[model samples]
Target chain A: MNIGIVGLGLIGGSLGLELYTHRQQTQAQISNNPSASPSPSYRILGISLEQKICDIAVKRGVVDEASVDLSLMSQADIIFICTPIAAIAPTVAKLIPYLQPHTILTDVGSVKKPIVENCSALWPNFVGGHPMAGNTQTGINAAQHHLFVNKPYVITPTANTPLESIKIVESIVDLLQAKIYHCQPEEHDRAVAWISHLPVIVSGSLIASLRQEDNPDVALLAHYFASSGFRDTSRVGGGNPELGLMMAKYNRDALLRSLQSYRQTLDKITTYIEQEDWQTLEKQLHQNHSDRLKFNL
Target chain B: MNIGIVGLGLIGGSLGLELYTHRQQTQAQISNNPSASPSPSYRILGISLEQKICDIAVKRGVVDEASVDLSLMSQADIIFICTPIAAIAPTVAKLIPYLQPHTILTDVGSVKKPIVENCSALWPNFVGGHPMAGNTQTGINAAQHHLFVNKPYVITPTANTPLESIKIVESIVDLLQAKIYHCQPEEHDRAVAWISHLPVIVSGSLIASLRQEDNPDVALLAHYFASSGFRDTSRVGGGNPELGLMMAKYNRDALLRSLQSYRQTLDKITTYIEQEDWQTLEKQLHQNHSDRLKFNL
Candidate 1:
């Protein structure tokens, strides 16, 4: 089997590393069973727009082969599109000419519906995936084989999606020891809007609102007092700007719904404060505290 | 010199531990210089309404002595009102009968203005102190001596406040190895509205909005999908409910202003997304990314 990875950024690079690691383990098993289902036959080929990134990826053992050309993916049984959301569809479109008859294309997009719609429209075997992992860090340099371990990896499958394609994604996630989840493309988009996409917008608004104060003294002192709470709340807002923008761009409607829900909650709290309704406000805040405890985050 | 710590919770208990450690260091210094400022002379007296908490604090050596009676604080030269914000003024009023002529009163309230107003009206030597440390964990069991080390410790002094009273609080902050910052009570309130108080409301709203979805399946799955981003963004929202409420109650006006500013930013981002203005939205997101980087948070 041959696996092709497009865009050697964090997801692609990490996937390459995990796949390579899995390949070695499978190779050890091949000594016992030459043609077992876990046969060590898969080759990881990475694709990138930057020749430099490709060379570095190969040196880092993220891939057996890498190229700037989409044609490099033609020999693979499966191809994972790990590009940014804005580039996923276009990258998939460029690879359409090279897609083999049995090629199964998938993606590690945070948003699902639009990417699924675009890619599945172009190719029938596309499965939309989202590995609910990663820190604010990005790029090839930050990638590691351990990223997906024990993390939830959701695969959004349209009715037109083949079972075999979904299982292929499951197999990779299984190799990385990630939890598997299956949901409809639209459902995945809506759910992540509240949890993932919505957080980006909410957190971004916080940073955008915090300006260097009119008084320089106050501004300097504000940073001194920002503390751990501010650091955690503002983390996602400081994530890859392009990636955050793309999530908002692709998952606009659901994210808008999430914003509305968030606004409604904020309005209620704000009105309680504005009215000096401390009892009700305290009650609401208590609910929030308990609500968060339920998640144990 | 003797120190009184009121309301033996996180701040009070931690201060007790720290003061005890400082007392030991001063004891060591006593051997070197019998008449120096570090004369090993200070004793820590802790006051709490709960007998169990008081008993446990003494047993844990958080204080040299602990008592439920307000009279226990009468012997101390300085008193730190470490009670919840909602209780600070009332606690101060109750402590007034016990305050000595030279007693210097300070507080570890997150919102300084209201507490300062009430306390200063009751006591002449009151200095508003806010040690910007502590996790969500509460009670004496969670307290440690090192909680305030190298952290920001703000002292908000009113025009009516005596320089001697401010220095007394500064000395304790210095003993804890914390960096001391002085500001007007109002300025401290406003600055923290952006960095501290506002984040509680922002984070709380995130959790309050994330409910058991209308669809139970969606609700359960949403938890599975709520990743590190959700955890970080919702952290402060899950903070001590009573503490967060008091911040909102005491610093209501400044926090309201922060909410308005945050809403305006959110409105702008929402408009861009609603209007499908990708270029503007992307630009705004880029600014957010850079804005947060400036804080290094």
Candidate 2:
């Protein structure tokens, strides 16, 4: 099946590579203009949306092909909307006129509810998806052919989302050799908020806390001493700040709720420390130890 | 030079195995008696400390005959006080009479200030040392000869600390094939508070937050969805909680100060989110991105 990928950045470019590796040719549409460089803004485009360069690369056999028109997506059997959260709505709105009734639509967004809510009605064929795989690198240059190998590809389907379309999307994800899991749109947001969104804030807070120290030596030393544990925790936080802020904005209620729950947990543990209740603290540690054993990772 | 290890738990036992592999013998004292377990209600007899274990083991041909010791660590060229943070102070107090002036004393506690402060005045032969190497496994059974290989062995020496004693401890750490660095008590505490202690709390907070969810399905799904990043970040939190709590409690002032600093940083970023100040958020992310780049990890 022919796949149409929008944006051609990390998510987009990676998806293109994965699709091609699966022996499916992809028709990619990069929306930015190459000759007219935009301001170095917070948009994902600054990192990935290279239309002209991508077009040249595609012409030179870097990719199968590239286009600037949304109509090109009309002929695609499956279309993956791999754009930023803000751009997803507009892109979906524009593509609605040309999106085939039977075409399977999916996205690689971290937050699923907003996009799914906004586009599910616009395109009855849409199935909200998030490939739970990413690296620190950005842009098409950072895209790897096997980046999605063995990663979880979450497919969030609403009551209105056609089962056949969900299956088609799953098949595409399977073709990339990614495992697929099913969840509701709201569930997807809450899950990502707990694991992905909260970590960013926590890690960012860690970095910011060190920055408050007046002594540059201490600040520098703290940074130097940060090990793999600190890096992993802070990985998502050191990502695009604008993207982080946007994620918090888009999933504000869920993120806030998660943060509130998290604050209570922190307070409880802190109180235990204050009271010198080592027994209760040990129980809490046991709970985490038992809980963490379930995941293969 | 023969070494005496007081406790045969994770740190102590690991040290024993490592010492044995290097063909250097160490006398170990472990409490084999069930009574001397962590709980006060448990029995307290014959809890073979590393010193005792190594003594018997060496005599029984479990190790070289050259390694043999009991109460008097006077024969020990150096004594490694490898025990829990809570046990470090009192144990050292009890063992001080046995420590000769030339016997270099060191430990592997996560917190160093209290340890250094407690022993510096009490034991003239003491030198505060923390081998920042560890694994999830504990006890003598988990001991490996190479546990300390390539890891940082932080040695905190006071202003009044003798230079010869410091060199002796450094040479011992070098024999273990670990990197050695020297810092003041406060500096060591603050550095560990940022890298080791702080990550534990943040990770525990994350685990506790996820556990608070009343929805069983979401909790189960979260367990399934937990990734390598979560595992790495939460490793310290899921560790021995009593030990974690003690580290936080012993280093309470530094940890509390760091936590307050962390919360304030989080508040600033949360405010940015509440107000949708994406520009300021972006700048902070860039700053963090740059700051993170400075770290070796």
Top candidate when judged by lDDT against the true structure:
1
What is the C-alpha local distance difference test score of each model?
0.86, 0.71
Candidate 1 regions with alpha-carbon error over 4 angstroms = A32-38, A136-141, A212-216, B32-40, B50-55, B212-215
lDDT by residue (A64-86, candidate 2, tens digit) is: 66667666677677777888788
Q: Reference contacts recovered by each candidate, as fractions?
A: 0.76, 0.51
lDDT, residue A171, candidate 2 = 71
Model 1 TM-score on a 0 to 1 scale: 0.92
Given candidate 1, what's the lDDT at residue B254?
Answer: 85
How big is the positional error of residue B21 in model 2, measured in Å on the Cα after superposition?
6.9
Candidate 1 accuracy as lDDT: 0.86
Query: What's the CA error at residue A150 for candidate 2, in Å?
Result: 3.9
User: What TM-score does chain B alone reach in each candidate, compared with the true chain B?
Assistant: 0.91, 0.81
